[model samples]
Target chain A: MKFSPLVDELIKSLQCLPGVGPRSAQRMAFHLLERDRNGGGKLGDSVSRAMSEVGHCQQCRTFTEQELCQICSNPKRTESGQLCVVESPADLLAIESAGQYSGQYFVLMGHLSPLDGIGPDDIGLDRLETTLSEGEWREIILATNPTVEGEATAQYIADIAHDCDVKVTRIAHGVPVGGELEYVDGTTLALSFSGRTAV
Target chain B: MKFSPLVDELIKSLQCLPGVGPRSAQRMAFHLLERDRNGGGKLGDSVSRAMSEVGHCQQCRTFTEQELCQICSNPKRTESGQLCVVESPADLLAIESAGQYSGQYFVLMGHLSPLDGIGPDDIGLDRLETTLSEGEWREIILATNPTVEGEATAQYIADIAHDCDVKVTRIAHGVPVGGELEYVDGTTLALSFSGRTAV
Candidate 1:
């Protein structure tokens, strides 16, 4: 609090951001003040500008300053068939970083949780249906995380998509690559044993 | 560019701040997207606001959103007749955390560096003279770091304040508590030996 008002406020404000403890916030505060005055200022400007400029792309929920995100606006991406579903923009980001998938994404901000009163409508399942109903989708890949709620959500969606002609599949979650048989957890080992294939 | 745009941009922006390397940037980026959404947003907002709103206080050069910093504006602090000069706001924060110094600060923002083309005017030495000339100051504590530039800066200020009736002093830097004598630098050991007092 003995710091300048701006310094104090900046440190305290950063404390609100997730995972940013008071000590880290103080370190950040010092960093901004001691170095990177221009870059830090530019980042602030960018954050506000991006916040105001970027909106969810009409087709996908990716962060974009324009009406369409760069990926959605690009003509190179496939116009039909492939669609990947994810839990949040963060997950979509992870997939994009891999650069392995060349398809579109549907982001559900949260997982379905009936216990928390979150129903199918709460996580964009209706939107998924509407998009599928457009008859543009071919293979719908459920790329949500391999957690309890994620599995349940995938199952529920798989049932609903069964009425349509689109081929529905959930992303596999088994033993990691190069993992030892002894190191694999019970769930993963069970999944691996059940999902085993011919040599 | 290999990272997601959001992650890449945030990481790049983070590099501008002091002490944040690739590791800290990655952690901070993940934190913003995942852990502390509200706090992260708040930190971003605070930074944006502070960068735009707060600037160097006209008198002491400390950052403040107002025309004057809180220390400058407060009547009680002014009456203390004490001015603690430091190289940066980080130093000011450190001293304040120590809670021993309740006096006002004159943050130089940078140390004296002739090779770097830095001069006294660049670091507010001229301003300090004007403030000292007002004859309100009693004690002046030179709290610069023990670096070469810091020592030189302190000596330079002491020279200028020679004629003033104020008591000028430099903080000692020698063997730290729990420091092994063998680990102490020869220079520090010399100072400790020379500055030794009779018990």
Candidate 2:
């Protein structure tokens, strides 16, 4: 009923992936062992190589092979001192895919979680302060998600920006563009009404 | 807008997993890089080791490190001449988890997909024929799925069984337990009616 030791290890390691439970992990292991060893090998190599090579960008804290992330290193992104602060690298990627934000980024990598003992220091808040103190940015955009923790993190960063004499702005919070009013939650509806602007 | 070359390769390779798409692949890659690099390394090592060391069982074509799979090598499993043929190792694991079957297994890996250029040999059917010719089995259970390709594969194997003077049996096709009749499809209904038992 159990797999061999090597298979078991692979399955166990797969559980580290978000949303993958034991059953799915087992399925992934069996799929690799049975059908596509080459793919599995490539995946393994990539994981190891990337993990060893990739580190936080010295400037923005996003993952990068070099000292600074590509975005932070680019000369074209520096003209506008409009910086976007996001909760994680994935969030940074989402904004990058939009292709509209030419501003640079600062990745928090995690939100402030007081209950879990994750303080500002845990999420590179000190580094963010050092970046803010440089006084290069004219405007800072808080693009964290609309969760309670995200809001708290934005407020904390906003206060820091005010201290540095930088203008701070929060991304809009409302019903999503394609979302139906009937299905939108109460808080979002209230925020939409409160944050509404002239058409 | 684009990940570095190493990050991009990792994202692409993670897509080799079943049900993972581009977005999820990126999420997985970031998870490994940011949170669980040690786990990622272990997963990579396990995948490489499993792929290189594991090969098809000489007896049943299931994955194994040795010449024969654990089931085939076990003395307790050899007493019965019942062989359950399935489409993939995942299916074999499903049956083994049920803990009722006392016999062995044969993993076909895939069904006869003529459209995809997968013939009998593609699923190791020749090896199956050779095993059938040995005349060791009292009954061969065709436990392939009920899809069209699966049915064709089972029928083709049944003919081979008939030629070898071995009895062939198909697993029952019935309304699933706890399923409502109103939602059961037509073909399933027909098969359930035709295969109804005295109970």
Candidate 3:
């Protein structure tokens, strides 16, 4: 037998999360019901509100409830004249957390996948081209994932930036810091060597 | 920078699940926002409804929107006269999935833990006692966990069942099936030996 109808429905609905499966969903449902009803209620309200209200920023396509996201609305960020392109908002946040860049971002939301019929327009490249042409960007940085699709997407965006007369660069591919060279993939090792710079 | 206000709030609220951390919560939030708004909306609605409407089953104390849980309300299950007591609804579901028990269940919601200030009433033991006294139960099956608190709870409930002139039995403790004896803990190995029956 299953949990009561409402409890069962809650469990099934929870499986929409990226990594959640049956057991995890059930545990989450029971945890909310038994221990943290207030938290659960808050979560429900927040999810509903976010789903209905959150929309893409007019400039960069990052998530926001406003017409323009906070970063896009900030004159200082816009004045930085450096645009970083990433595959998702999570990637944008990762770069922000590093505290290395102070530029505006254009979130692709996903890379171009020709096999899946995902093209330039699907990842908002048309908007990226328009921004590149309109903004006084000194440089465009591609920080998409290190995969075939990401490489193709970066190349495509780089061409667009070149046509707009803006310099473009891809984030370096190399053995990650704190990682052993022996454990690093051959392609990454080769790229590290090819892209090496003098100290 | 963090996500926009509503998206950020949604990520934080998603962390209320048992194993979800900041990273997992962010991933979940972005996933729902980008890919599955319908599922996320349904999750929110179900969670809100369940939080507001679901309550303890009056008869067995398991979670249910109705006065009695499905198992408690079913006449066929009630007629079995064997009441299995478990520490949580999850545990009750586990037993039901095993397809071994057909009797009604009494969910304790939690075992007795006095140091944490949880008492009999905190786990609905008063209601359990009332049901035990009022029903014509043939046997009371104690299926609480094997922890110290669980043992204490089972002993306490056993005394109550004894007062009602009902036979009480604790689920056996032993090395788990399919587990190597060499890897089994000494306590479990000893229990396996002590509880061994004639072959």
Candidate 4:
């Protein structure tokens, strides 16, 4: 009636991934069994090792197997005296890929959502405050997502940064580059108008 | 600039799954590392175990950890004197889910593809021939997909079954039961008309 017990278990366990459902899980399991056994074995080992070994970097709260993440440990990154606060490691990577900012980052791991009972300390804001106070940073950039929770998180961290005598700035919100104004949402259009430059 | 070595490797390894690209791989890796380490660990163990232990069923060629799959091992399944041939385990599962077929199955694992150099043996047709010649089936049902290669494969197997002195039947091709006539493609519509059964 169903796949063998081990196959069924593999399919079920694969559903734990984000956006994967029963059908996708089945396809993935079959794909591994039928086509790419070597890749599957490697995936299994890598996932196991990463799960057991990877931990949060003590300095920036980003994922790493070491005491500090690569970016956090780099002295050149600290010389910029600018700290970018992001909700997750993915967000940090997005900013890093832009190749514009060379400052250090502090990963929140998640934004504050009081309705869900998540508070500042839950997102590692206390640690952010400690870093802001101890480090000779000239500016703290709030680079969290533009969502309500991300905004609230940024504001809370901004207040903490102000108390630590660091100038706080939020990333500018506006129409994305190469975006057509006609297709832009009302809220984003309004923000673009309000935040427009003199040029 | 990049994730830690372990994290990077996890992301890359995760991409081995079908339909997963770089972005999805990164998301999966981070999700496992951040929120579902327990699930990730379980998935790792399950995948590893399945890859190492699961092998083709000696009788039906479906994936199994045992010499014979459940259906092949069941005495009652052989009572119908019918064997359904399908392209993959997923197809077998689909037919089984319909609850209409109690007959045994022969999983081809893939259809015949000459351009890609996949011969009959590559899809285990040689094994299928052995089964067809040895089993006491009154009829062999060809349930391969309606695609070009699948149809060719079904035709080839039908010939083999005929040579083995067993009656062969192909599952009827037509518009799907719930699909709208206007939305159905020309080939399916034509098949539906041609394959219509009189009340």
Candidate 5:
């Protein structure tokens, strides 16, 4: 579809969002232009403000305006001395929404991918090591995904925690909450059965 | 997930986009804060600039920074004296991308919805009447959607065009390209069969 240069640029810029495609971007651009200029203005201003103000937290590497994120800075959260290591801020937010985890978090920013040139230091693994050594953590939860890279990263961090005499635990992997057993994949079914607990 | 006030506001503001819910908004917010600050900044600036600069064309009611849209202002396009009336700017873009039509367009911005308090005047039908009266046109193409409201609007506009002794045509609605007859809905199948033409 043909758009003015300004509208064209806006549509292209919107594609940076995950899962948004060219058609969806066009729809968003027209929506902003036609019905919701006020909403568009607010979105623009908020995005700019967030981009400029947000930065990595000093302790956990999560996005925050201050040096430490809300979770890292809060004394109540730190009292648990239980830390969860995650692959990204989105994962951290997911755990937070579950409302079960009371401990603090350490975000890896990304999983290790040697082919992609991301190694030990690239995802702040060295910082993670230092944090493990310094903190008096009773246990460390490796909440990374169950992909091959996630497993490798978890193992590497587990070795580091072992060296520091800290306990390391991996979050369980199994069939998803709503998945039917018949429709579940073989690997997930096996993992769910093997990781089964007493009823 | 609990976010700082600024982050929360940004996520909330992002929900104005069509099909984006709270989860997608949160993901978008975190993405901007983490990986795509530059894109976020650019989108914000572009949205504001478009909102402030873009306005409806005086003649056709389509969006443009100038008093008249590119199509309306172009001397070559106006000479055809063929006007295509559409529901919104998106529909105009879709037709323009097809590159078959050389005529100009008039955007209604919305369909007539009586329950929602929208009427003929609300969608600039009066302005359309004025434009039709002033212009020397061969035909008026009613390019609104094929829904009930669309048919009503097209009939209403056709009545007006009839008064002006202007020929009115409705865009054909039939089986879509690549549509399988077995899978086609009853209404669409009926419409396609009824609108059939001899080869």
Candidate 6:
């Protein structure tokens, strides 16, 4: 039943991901050794690379490897005078994969839930306000999730953006009521995409 | 939505986990940044610890840190001549957590799936044969899973051990039909312990 410290450590480390229990973690550890030796090797390399290279963008709160995240730095993508605000990089990718919008983003890392003591300041709302005050974006899109906390966040952002010169908008109902975008089927997601009405 | 290369890379890297999709991966990346700033910082450190530190034991095929795994080196663990042979370290841990066994282990690392060309030699069966041939073991318990592939692998080991002078045994009855030991509750697993009948 005993294992080497590092091998044991590796198994424990894999458990940190959501839903992976001890057994799955053990399976994953062995999987790295068995089916995808190269993936295992690549996984180690990637973790180290992302850890050292990727960082936060001061201006937009999204993760970046350089002074700004690639989205904020690039000159080619249609900046379009629109800023889509999201709760995390994951949500950003969900929107990106749909291939709908051509605007930039502001990833809010956390949602505003006061019971958890996550307010505007806790979720970098003040920075979003200051950036909106500068009047760079034509329409500020609130793309937080449809959760209770997310709706509160959207309302909070709407109030702040409305005071600024920017046109306040909450990106509409592509996501289902009480449904996580992660669980939504691709077709439904696409339907939600086409049906997005103004907030 | 347009994103930076850093953003893209982070998402793909996180998707390496079993159940995590692209969206979940994105959320995880953001979750790490927001909630576990210290844990996030530690992730980079743990990646290298796991990567460089883990490797297969030269003797047993079980993962280990040193030249020998902790079990192989320990004096407290049974040197009592019984070897519970399993296909992976995960299996060994499952059996061990039941607090039932007082023997050492010989993990085959994989099963003998002939169609896949994973025969005796391919799955470290050769090493097991040599260990059995040495006549040091009192019994070799074939504790492979109850799945078809696992059954096939177990049969192959039983066949090889048939000619050996030592007693050969197989764990029985506690595991559900077509159920994985990973999913079985600990109490049932313990009951499986008391219920173990020989091959």
Off by over 4 Å in 1: A26-37, A65-80, A175-186, A189-193, A197-199, B1-15, B18-49, B133-137, B163-165, B174-199
Q: What is the CAPRI rating of model 3's predicted complex? A: high
Candidate 2 positional error at B102, Å: 0.7
- Predicted complexes: DockQ each: 0.36, 0.61, 0.87, 0.88, 0.64, 0.35
Q: How many residue pairs clash in each candidate?
A: 6, 0, 0, 0, 0, 3
> DockQ for the candidate 6 complex?
0.35
Ranking by TM-score: 3, 4, 5, 2, 1, 6
Q: Residues B1-199, candidate 3: write the lDDT tens digits.
A: 8778899899999999999999899989999999999999999999999999999998899999999999988999978799999999899989999999999899999999999999999988888889889989999999999999999999999998998899999999998889998899999999989999998
iRMSD values, candidates in order: 3.6, 1.5, 0.7, 0.6, 1.7, 2.7
Q: How displaced is residue B130 in candidate 6, in Å?
A: 2.0
Model 1 accuracy (lDDT, Cα)? 0.76
Q: Looking at model 4 chain B, which ten-residue stretch has the lowest summed lDDT?
A: B128-137
**Docking quality (DockQ) of candidate 1:** 0.36
> Considering summed lDDT, which 10 consecutive residues are worst modelled in model 4 chain A?
A126-135
Q: Cα RMSD to native, each candidate? A: 4.2, 2.5, 1.4, 1.5, 2.4, 6.5
Error of 1 at B35 (Å): 9.6
What is the fnat value (0 to 1) for candidate 2?
Answer: 0.69
Proportion of native contacts kept per candidate: 0.43, 0.69, 0.85, 0.90, 0.68, 0.37
Scored against the native two-chain complex, candidate 5 gets a DockQ of 0.64
What is the Cα-based lDDT of residue A80 in candidate 1? 60
Q: Model 4 Cα displacement at B71 (Å)? A: 0.6
Q: Give a tens-digit lDDT track for model 5, residues A7-78.
A: 778889999888899999989988999889999989988888888887788899987778888888889998
lDDT of 6 by residue, A1-199 (tens): 5456666677777666566688777777777665665556555565556656777887777777778766777665445988898988778778888898878788898798878777789788888888888657788888998788898889989988878867878766566679998998886799687986689
Residue pairs of candidate 1 with colliding backbone atoms: A16-B39, A17-B36, A17-B39, A17-B40, A18-B35, A18-B36
Q: Over the stretch A102-173, how does candidate 2's per-residue lDDT look in tens digits?
A: 989999999999999999998888988988998598899999988999999999999999998889999999
lDDT tens per residue, model 4, B1-199: 8999999999999999999999999999989988999999999999999999999999899999989999999999999999999999999999999999999999999999999999999998898888989878889999999999999999999888889999999999988888899999999999989999999
List, residue by residue over A102-188, the lDDT tens digit for candidate 4. 999999999999999999889998888888888798899999999999888888888888798889999999999999999999999
Model 6 CA lDDT for position A111: 91
Instruction: Tell me the docking grade of candidate 2.
Output: medium
User: How far does residue B107 in candidate 2 sit from its true spot (Å)?
Assistant: 1.7
Candidate 3 structure quality by residue, lDDT tens digits, A14-90: 99999999999999999999999999999999999999999999989999999999988988897778999999999
